[model samples]
Target: MKKREVLLLAFAEHPEQREKCWISLSECNFSCKGCAALSKKERSRLISSKDLAYLVFKSSRYFWGKIIKIAVITGDEITLNPESLLSLISNLKDYSVKYFELSTNSFMIDEDLLKELIKLKLPILVKMDLKAYDEKIYKEYSGKSEVRVDESLNLFEGIDRRAKLIIKNWKIRYLTINPILTSK
Candidate 1:
């Protein structure tokens, strides 16, 4: 199979820990109002998943004098490229990364993607950002309807139930963040 590639932004050590790092990705499915990533003038370059894994590993070693223990993959929307994301995770595991935290908008997740993630056999924490529950609020904030997010949530729930039966220890966890919105 051909290896997938993703748009990489940067790799940096976690604020408090040398053994932890953050892998930032560029581009997003949604153009949320006031998003900092959207405001940036610079564009991220596309990189193969294997190359990205190597760069992240090297960065951790260079900065921390050790391998990365935890890698948090965050982006405006990391789930935009499911294949590349899975490849990145698999590559990171090859580097012996112990844990992963993936932050996403939860608008792109589907059954196949979730299954691929579970097959990686790595402990992954999924941070699902729900812009807003109400359709109007969601549209106002993200300039997109909440229908996709709803579908993602439903799909995840169904897959997660089946996954629990297959895996002895299901390591994936979901965190929902609903930002408090103020009317203009």
Candidate 2:
């Protein structure tokens, strides 16, 4: 059977007052309770890397002279589809994209993935979510252990030539805090 693939597009505000066209892939490892996006049960079609890159290249033309600031690739968990995701990003290097942003939860990032990303040498920004500071809260919300979060963050920070590596905190719309935890 073929792997499931999806690309959701939208426009959003990027850092430094730039506007970016956002593309999101679906299916995630974690199903955080408050997430607004639909569940992973939704089906998706398969798209090849060349076709994906072509879509982004064509999308850039809509802005004309205004330089399409960046192409933001996000998802329920893009890191889960490392090969496809990287392939698409790598192929976009020749397009008008000035930068590429990959938004992920950091759970799927291992040392190997980090090494591969560094090797790509694409102007990429990683928007990662820390979720929660406490292990219990993190597990409660994201249904996963927090071990990989710190491990991934530390690995990303340890990159020797890290001028290109950016560790970012993702935004959460609503967070319910436990009074006991909040009081501490």
Candidate 3:
């Protein structure tokens, strides 16, 4: 499938550190209730992965006088477009980014995409937001079925096992499940 155009919602340096930056992407696969991305009204024009990388690099240099060492790729559902995400990461690496942290809902990740992500050879910390453990609660909160999350979790486990046996020094930390607990 052709890569979708990336709709950049925001780009800014970390509140406490200039060497870190956040790249927020627009749109999502899931319509989770009370999602922060839902409150973001302004969005940049759709751009290609290469252009987005250049813009990020330029913005970093303009604001901090240097390229950011760490990039946090966060959005409503960053994995919605796997090709675009991979392309963006590849382009960012070209600018010599030291590390990447991807915060996602973990609904769109599949085995193929996971393999591609493993091939990146960069240290990536995946922060997966688990909406809820109960199927009914998950569906109610995210407007999506929980089966996808289970699939993703299984994929992460399988990859982790394979990495341990095949690649002794895997850089990707796999999945860090962060459940979003809410009081009803």
- Pick the TM-score winner: 3
C-alpha lDDT values of all predictions? 0.69, 0.67, 0.71
* Tens digits of per-residue lDDT for model 1, 71-120: 88886778877888888888888998999888898888888898888888
Across 1-184, the per-residue lDDT of candidate 3 in tens digits comes to: 3333333424344444536666766667887888776324533345667877887788777766888788888866788788899999999999988898888888888889889989999888887789998999999999999998889878877443322222233222112112222111
Query: By TM-score, highest first, what's the ranking?
Result: 3, 1, 2
lDDT of 1: 0.69
Clashing pairs in 3: none
lDDT of 3: 0.71
Cα lDDT of model 2 by residue, 1-184, tens digit: 1232553556544345565667666678987888865324443445666776676566555544344567778878888867877777777776656788888999998888888888987777787877889999999999998998888888876554334444354321111111121101
Can you list the residue pairs that collide in candidate 2? none
**TM-scores, in order shown?**
0.75, 0.74, 0.76
Candidate 1 lDDT score at position 64: 59
Candidate no. 3 TM-score: 0.76
How accurate locally is residue 75 in candidate 3, as Cα lDDT from 0 to 100? 64
